[model samples]
Target: MQKLTIQWQRLLNDKNQTCPRCSETGETVNTGVLKLKNALAELGIEVELIQKAIDFSVFENNPLQSNSILINGKLLEDWIGGETGKSKCCDVCGDSECRTISFGENTFESIPENLIIKAGLLAAAELIEN
Candidate 1:
């Protein structure tokens, strides 16, 4: 079976806690992965999810890197024709602005599961085409 990889990264404080946005996105990602697995199984495609944690030091320099998702090695926003932006996050982020995704008129701090599933489906389509 072929494989589709979805990678999500977020900032982790010393206590291994992340901002609310990242935490919610993590839950969405997990749900998305499960959905994708079921949806793609018949197509001989395997769904793989990789969760990465960015240290506080790294987040201090580039907070925007946190709460990022990549499908098939490409940004989720790229796959979905969304725009990437940033906004001030919660205390776990410590005054840093975290990543946001903009689609049309709406902008989301915590990425929604629909977007994740959409990206995963698009990626799975590409995998099959190739």
Candidate 2:
């Protein structure tokens, strides 16, 4: 299998945390993506909403985006496989890990950077013409 490539910049400036789940937070974020996505799909939805209390805390240390990729999304499953290996346990809740989310045109798989730039230019041209 191809190794997953995840490149991301931290959302919050501060990485320090006194949260209770600091120890396993990393695991939670990683596994949560897969589980969350699957859950949403089962419900016949394309998007998954993760409230602060239900999802990861907005604690000073928490990231706006935990990983480079959002789990349960269209493109990532090819790399992450099904909900068995990487997306099973909830590193955060320690519940069964029920929630799952998907990708939109804004997502990397849908609108890659190159396409975004091209589309942006086209929109800009249309605006200028108007």
Deviation of model 1 at 94, angstroms: 1.1
Model 1's TM-score against the true structure: 0.97
Worst 10 residues of 1 by lDDT: 88-97
Candidate 2, residue 47: how far the Cα is off, in Å = 31
Q: Please give the clash total of every predicted structure, in order.
A: 0, 6
User: Highest lDDT, which number?
Assistant: 1
RMSD of each: 0.7, 15.9
Please write out the lDDT profile of model 2 over residues 23-129, one tens digit for every residue.
23334443443443344345433333232231334322333233223322322323323121212223333322222223332222111333322322333333335
For model 2, name the residue pairs that clash: 28-91, 36-99, 36-100, 36-101, 37-100, 37-101
Give candidate 1's error at residue 29 in angstroms: 0.4
Local distance difference test, each candidate: 0.93, 0.30
